[model samples]
Target chain A: MQPAHSNTVIEASKLGLTFQTSDGPVRALSDVDLSIGKGEFVSFIGPSGCGKTTFLRVIADLERPTSGSISINGMSPQQAREARAYGYVFQAAALFPWRTIENNVALPLEIMGISRDERKARIKRTLDLVNLSGFEKKYPWQLSGGMQQRASIARALAFDADLLLMDEPFGALDEIVRDHLNEQLLKLWGQTNKTICFVTHSIPEAVYLSTRIVVMSPRPGRVTDVIESTLPRERPLDIRESPEFLAIAARVRDGLRAGHSYDD
Target chain B: MDRFRDKIIPVTTLLAGLVVLWYVFAVIMNAPVQRDMDRRAGEDPRFSEFIGKTLAQAKPTLPAPHQVATNFFENTFTRKITSNRSLVYHAWVTLSSTLLGFAFGTVLGILIAVGIVHFIALDRSLMPWIIASQTIPILAIAPMVVVVFAAIGVTGLLPKALISTYLSFFPVAVGMVKGLRSPEILYLDLMHTYNASASQTFWKLRVPASVPYLFASMKVAVAASLVGAIVAELPTGAVAGIGAKLLAGAYYSQTIDIWSALVAGSVVAVLLVTLVGVAGRIVERSMGGRPA
Candidate 1:
């Protein structure tokens, strides 16, 4: 196992992706280079159609980048997938409606051949971590949207995966729900010590959650700016009122405008 | 009260209207007109009584109600399961074949559905043929199937069950295919992220997801199998089954007997369908297990 202090958990170079659509060969991404350090919370903030999701898909091996080499923990993304290196949460909660909250959380552990007793213990712990202990018996439809999403995060955490990939997981929630989830997510990261790569469109959310924010441009999407956060490690809800928070928010805005005119 | 008024009241009113119309026609239509024909036929002066008895035996349409009821009692209670003349024996013969056939068909349907879901070529090629197969009337080709199987020296339950299987499988196949594909794209991506293999995804997601659909389709399949078994018996000129009894009564102009046998067959079909529905509920509940 690599040391926790190792700076890079994911490395991508000269990554590109193209789709053969009816219109023509559409270049979805072009010449992307990025790295995520161990135990770091990196957020990809970009305009619509900026290929942020696509990049995440590539890293997860759900899609293969048309060009460039990428590795997760020194293995190819596909290899990493077989080894179950990371857990991914999507924009939607994506809970299996047929399964209750507990079963949904237990799914990955079940597949990974964990014994039943251990699986039960892990599921309870993870559900509690996401504040969903009482909801173990509830089906996805019975819960509020935010609760379903928290269950999804708990599912990702249950397998003890070292890396977590979240694609706008709270995008559909109300602002209040999103804020609560954001705080919980930070605590989850702190406790689990997992490297995270989150993709989103919210400027404040990106700036608030990320240790580093990678701003991306659209139309052959590419990274334009990489900003390291200057906020204190001990952040609370009141941090949003701080001048430092406002300054970083302003920097993210400038980066968004200067990199890509997202309103196309 | 409003919910009941909105949905049930209209339906009950319509059904009541139909029953009233039937009574009016029975009492009012062709009373004297049929008297002239009854006299011309010149059976007896008690012609009205004869018509009444026949109507009571077969139904309002032909023989009547009482005659058919009498025949059913005679065949089912007066005789026995081993008796060739007994409707109970014939019904048992038919039920056994139908039950076996339904089981075979359900298993085959699930296998084919799973295969089609997993393989692209099977999905493209097999599905069209399955749809087309149902359009071909069972009545048209039942004799040919019987003859072909008989020629090959396959006898007894096999031919009857094959026909039942043929009729029953289509509903299960269609239901299962839809169920297997019912998961949203996002859920599939979740499986992909978990690095779940195709088989793992199927057992944990697709198979469990398909349960409600499977049970629903099973009800249809069971009913279809009963229909198939009865139809299969017709082509064979079966001597010891309900279909044979109906055919014999028809040839002898025993209209009351024929009508009674048809009602008996319908009753059996309803019973079988009801059993399947109950079983489906049980299976669904069991597979769902104790909550989470």
Candidate 2:
């Protein structure tokens, strides 16, 4: 295996996607070039219509690019997807209401045809990682919104994939819960050492969790700037108030503001 | 216990009220014949005697509840099950056809639904035709179906089952289509990200998601199948089922027999529907679905 620091998990070049609707073609992403290295926590931050989520979708092979090529670990996204290279967490928990938490988390594993004993062990370990150890018997509706999202994360982590693609997984939660989850997520990253691509609209959230932030603009989305954070890997909630964290966040904000002029 | 009481009380009250109204209507409708008989006999029948005769007529226009019940009890219990006059025997005959047709209909419906959901062309082309089939009255077509089947030498239970299948498959097809498509795009994407095979996605996601819809449709389908079986029997002039009993009653003007056969048919329908409901509860619970 390649050394972790030298391994590149994702690579994209001049990628573009345009959706053809009855009204007309809507350009969701354009001219994007990005490379995410192993163990990197990258945040894609932009406005609502911006292609942050679309870019992640492209990486996950859920959506295809209209132009340019992208690869995960030197393979096409489709091939990589078929190989189960990454786990994806959506904005909504999206758990099957019919399935209990344990069963929901075990879904992908079951699809992969893993043995029951192995599935049980992984489920227990992953649920513990998300601090959801005892709530396995409860259904998604029985849990709080935050807890549901965590369960979804556990589902993604169950297979021990090296890469994770999260699309605003906590956007629906309140401030207090979001803050708590942000810290827990950072700790999760530290423990698993998985490369993460997160999409968010919040500046502090992007700054607090990411080792690097890619600022994007809407209307044929293009990458405006990519800012590398100097903040330590072990960041606390109060780190959001620190000067180094503020400096990185200010840069992301400025990049976003600069991209708005592209529409004019 | 409180919830059970809440449901039982209203149902009991409604049923009692219905029985009272039925008794009143029976007395009014049968009164004229009784009075004419009294005049012909040159005897002035008292009001009390008239009321009693109306409620106990041998061939009243609308059979009294007790008269129908007594006839039903005698036919069902006093006669051997093998007797041609036994309501129990006729009910069993009709019920066998109903069950066979219901199974065939459920299977056909699920297949059609899977096709419609999976193939866009089928959805666009076949769905409207399936719906239009239901618009033609079953009564108008039942005789033709029986005659056609007889010409082809397909007699007995199979023909009746085919008719039931025709009537019952529509609901299952429509419901299964809706259920298969009920999963959100996010869930579909989740499956895609897992790189699950098409069959895997269908069995794990679509089929399980469609369970509630399937059960709901089955309830309707079972009732429709029972009706289809009865209708199928009527046109074929079959002499072994409830439909045959009705035809014989009509020929002899045995209104009491007709009413008793009607009640027996209704009881069969209720039992079939209840069986489907109980089955749905068991499957849903085992699958960890919401409690009823």
Q: How well does each candidate reproduce the native contacts, as fnat?
A: 0.53, 0.86
Residue range with the least summed lDDT across 10 consecutive positions in model 2 chain A: A1-10
Q: What is the lDDT of residue B107 in candidate 2?
A: 97
Instruction: Write down the DockQ of candidate 1.
Output: 0.48
Model 1 segments more than 4 A misplaced: A1-5, A262-264, B1-14, B23-33, B41-89, B286-292
Q: Local distance difference test, per candidate?
A: 0.85, 0.93
Off by over 4 Å in 2: A1-6, A261-264, B151-153
Clashing pairs in 2: none
Write down the worst ten-residue block by lDDT for model 2 chain B. Answer: B283-292
TM-score of chain B of each: 0.83, 0.97
Kindly provide the TM-score obtained by chain B of candidate 2 when compared with the true chain B.
0.97
Candidate 1 local lDDT, A1-264, one digit each (tens): 333235688988898999889999888889898878898899999888889999999999999888888889888899998899998999888887767889889889988899999999999999989999888988777899999999999998998889999999999999999999999999888888899999999988988898999998888888988999998656798898889889988988898899876465
